[model samples]
Target: MKTCNNCGAQVEDVAKFCPECGFKFGSIAEPRAVVTDMYDHTSEFSPEDIANNKLYAILMYCVSLMGIIIGLLAAGDSPYVRFHIKQSLKLFICEVILGLITGALFWTVIVGIVGGIAIVVLAVVDIICLVNACKGLAKEPPIVCKIGFLK
Candidate 1:
């Protein structure tokens, strides 16, 4: 039996979720490649750096512009925080550009549809970056990783 991390419910080892709280335990067969990609940067930084600057790194995504400023001011020397700040800054710039393009083309209904979809994509990328920061990993976020900004 395995204990559910979400609600402390006991479940069978083969179970994919917590029956009591609906928390996803995930499948044991999930691909290792996906997991590895997300945490591939774990060995790049010292645990001390990740532990000490995690909050500032998370802040970089939580508040965008202000978070960048705060992260730089409070944890300027932390490579982990710096990595996240650069990633978050790229996301911020992408959002700004998307918003401007959408606003300028709002008169066309097509722009609304395309903009809405783009916004969702950007949100997902932002979540990925935020999660990586919270996990103290410097994994570059998908899509955002290709953007050439804040380098």
Candidate 2:
């Protein structure tokens, strides 16, 4: 048996690609392997790949921009992208909930100063997280903005 480099799943030795994860295997030459390696590196994404994967990248770029369903769908077949998408979704949900609560408090009880301050803080944190995502970093949002329910 041979292990799939992508997902570490074992497959029959005669298999040219991993059945579970679809990772191709067994190149005949060093040049071919090098080309394969280049494509496998996520950080070295080409413009075409980025364009093709634009929805996935955008869904991952802002946790509060869309629903978790969209993020999950965009993250298809890529664990690294999925990780960021999931994290962003969690942060987005938290920001939404906080915004609603703060708005309600300000409008219903006239606690305008405190509610406005809370909203400002949440917006700043959300912007920071979005900026990080645009840079393709997988850093999680601040602790207060993360949804513990999913993690």
**Highest-TM-score candidate:** 1
lDDT, candidate 2, 121-150, per-residue tens: 766766776665565544556654334566
Regions of model 1 farther than 4 Å from truth: 1-40, 148-151
Worst 10 residues of 2 by lDDT: 32-41
lDDT of 2 at 22: 77
Give the per-residue lDDT of model 1 (tens digit) for 70-93. Answer: 999988888878887777888898
Q: Score candidate 1 by TM-score against the native.
A: 0.70
lDDT of each: 0.82, 0.60
TM-score for candidate 2, please give it: 0.50
